[model samples]
Target: MENNQEGILLTSAEQSYLWTTYQADTMAVCVFNHFLQHIKDNEIKSLIVFALQLSEEHANFIREIFIKEKIQIPQGFTESDVNLHAERLFSDVFYLNYIKNMAKGGLVTYGRVLQNVYRKDILSFFSACLSQSIELNSRAIDISLKKGLAIRPPTIPYLEKLEFVHKQSFILEGLGRREALTGTEVTNLFANIQTNYIGTSLATAFSQVCKTKKAQNFFKRGKEIALKHIEVFSSYLKMSSLPVPGTYEQMVTQSKDAPYSDKLMMFHFSLMIYSGVGNYGLSTAETQRSDLVADYTRLNAEILKYSEDGANIMIAEKWLEQPPLAANRRDLAKG
Candidate 1:
């Protein structure tokens, strides 16, 4: 942690918050601008505009703090990374779904940062961010539901009696048929499926537009992984006689022209892969069924390896930024 005699220095937590927000907001600006150029739905377009404004405001506020602290601001994604005149990469519905997922991520991120932040100003800033994220999440949900675009988890029949676990089979797969999934299990499964759907679409688009063969190969591999995960999850739903959530892969255009720089696209997919792994871990914990837990565990391992490869690519390209770290006592001693 950096500190001064006057106690005006930024703590590690505050530094982390500022850095992450700057990067996220910068990426959001590029993504939102591209969406704005292609979006046709007035309702979805309005929400995107609102979200973009918030992201821009956040970027500006974080930059001001970085300037005050004399910290070098990260040159994240920018107009140079995006082409507003490029052909559409995703449909309008994909834009709405992307924002909805982003809002959920924002709420979770702000809430976690608020817990770690100790500086009064930083705490207050994250508190407000959490509030705004909540509002955006609610609005996105309302719009999605109203327009019949929300991919809700299947609802089961109401239980008539309180039942207790009678056998170990309740948590394990038995020799025979397994019981139907609980509501929490269903929710987790569907959420994972939904994320993979979005990933598949994005990876497909990137595969077609990335400049380098290496980047294109990575995107193509990611698309295959997402499709396999979706199939695995869809099978679970089908076994339960639940309707599998549909994807918007068909909405991607055939244009091979890159709308985003290769670096930006790689970073964006890396973020999605990391987020997916986190979600899978949480989903694994929420499941009591042995088979489903095993599935999540195995899939998480696959993506974890993939994410490591992505990091290596970023490092090779000098695109990966170093986050805040504690002082190196060994170096100080050597000096």
Candidate 2:
């Protein structure tokens, strides 16, 4: 063993975290390689090929770190274990959708990891990963649009800045009383918390599986966003003296069973994103009456971006739920 004490600098917690992340990245590369062979779309296939190379490289680097640290690395899922040829039996549309969904999960994970790490080397590693993730996601988004696979969310016109008169009479009257939360408000809060948990868990898993330093760093940043959301929700629960929900854990893959198909995974995540946006909107509306309106509004805006990205992936996969459009409105008017 190379002098174990000379260059190994990560703390035990950091080492363990890196090891777990590396294992996940190993699995991700295997899956992407499988995707590369199975996908027929030349553009998507090219993108996956590039992504796979990046993932494999990162995996090797993490393995090197483990070797230097005298740590035993876990053997995560790999292409050898999965039936890529068998998966190819499925439609090309399904395959593309699957990769896109997995990418969204990865985006979330990189975001979180970036938030938790403080070391210069670790931070640099995550930053690079984040950049790659953005590039990959951008490519996916473009493909989805060109292929007519993207879904668009409802958008309202942006209003120019306008000043409103301040009113303090109501604030003065209710200054001493603690406001009660309505049932609808409580329900929305619970839903938003659940959505954040799911999003974060998926993101963390993606980061763990993606192999490039750029991608891993991106995953770290995603992890941070999820953690922050968790804190925000937990604080609210605490103020109400409610118990915090358990941390969301990734579903374990069975030794015998194939992991979730990519299409299904993307569809499931897209739903979560949509639900999160709706819940946030409701929460923001309710908070309008509270002193925390500014805080909730900021959070809502951040989550909205996440939700929009999720919707875009769904569109790329052609898995979005049905919604009324202008044509439908015109038909209804004619009727």
Per-candidate clashes come to: 0, 34
Give the residue spans of candidate 2 off by over 4 A.
1-8, 87-90, 161-335
TM-score of each candidate?
0.94, 0.49
Worst 10 residues of 2 by lDDT: 250-259
For model 2, state the Cα shift of residue 114 in Å: 2.6
TM-score of 2: 0.49
User: Which candidate number maximizes TM-score?
Assistant: 1
lDDT of 2 by residue, 167-198 (tens): 55233325543454444454455545555665
In order, candidate lDDTs are 0.86, 0.58
Instruction: Give the TM-score (vs. native) of candidate 1.
Output: 0.94
- Name the candidate that leads on lDDT: 1
What local lDDT score does residue 49 receive in model 2, on the 0 to 100 scale?
A: 83
